[model samples]
Target: MTNLLLLIPVAIGLGLLGLFAFVWTLRSGQYDDLDGAAERILHEDDEY
Candidate 1:
């Protein structure tokens, strides 16, 4: 019972932390260029 009390809060805290980090990434435009890398790789750059 004592272990459950400690572990429950720790698990909740970790879940919340992960949710916040995911939200931050969404707001920071991290997914805005999902296809950019694929498109860029197909184009060759002459500048070495």
Candidate 2:
């Protein structure tokens, strides 16, 4: 159908966008502190 032609490109574009964002996050250190964040929640600052 004609709708499929339009939707296919949109879906591919979205997939590519998601991939780019994932790569960007890796390069930006977004996931660098995976374990630290979890441990941090269990910690309390002495000042508090």
Candidate 3:
């Protein structure tokens, strides 16, 4: 029971931290181009 007292706050803090990070990414445009990497690799700028 003693361990639970300390663990609950730690768990809540970690969950909040993760939520903040995800929100930050959303605001920073980190998810703007989900398919860009895969689609970009199929195109080439070099001439054969």
Candidate 4:
């Protein structure tokens, strides 16, 4: 019973942390160029 008190908050905190990190990525344009990234890999750069 005592362990549940501690484990519950820890689990909730971890879940909230993950949610916030996901939201941050969305707002930071991390997913805005998903297709661009895939296509870019197929092209070659001219850099020496």
- Report the number of the highest-lDDT candidate: 1
lDDT tens per residue, model 3, 2-48: 99999999999999999999999999999999999999899996866
TM-score of 2: 0.87
lDDT of each: 0.99, 0.96, 0.97, 0.97
As a TM-score, model 4 comes out at 0.91
Stretches > 4 Å off in candidate 2: none
Task: Name the better of 2 and 4 by TM-score.
Answer: 4
Query: What are the clash counts of all predictions, listed in order?
Result: 0, 0, 0, 0
For candidate 1, the clash count comes to 0
Clashing pairs in 1: none
lDDT for each residue of candidate 1 in 1-48, tens digit (9 for 90 to 100)? 999999999999999999999999999999999999999999999999
Q: Candidate 4 regions off by >4 Å?
A: none
Model 3, C-alpha of 15: deviation from truth (Å): 0.1
TM-score of 1: 0.88
Instruction: Arrange candidates by TM-score, descending.
Output: 4, 1, 2, 3
lDDT of 4 by residue, 1-48 (tens): 999999999999999999999999999999998799899999999998
Error of 3 at 3 (Å): 0.1
The Cα error of candidate 3 at residue 2, in Å, is 0.7
TM-score of each: 0.88, 0.87, 0.86, 0.91
* Model 4 weakest lDDT span, ten residues long: 29-38
Cα error, candidate 4, residue 37 (Å): 1.1
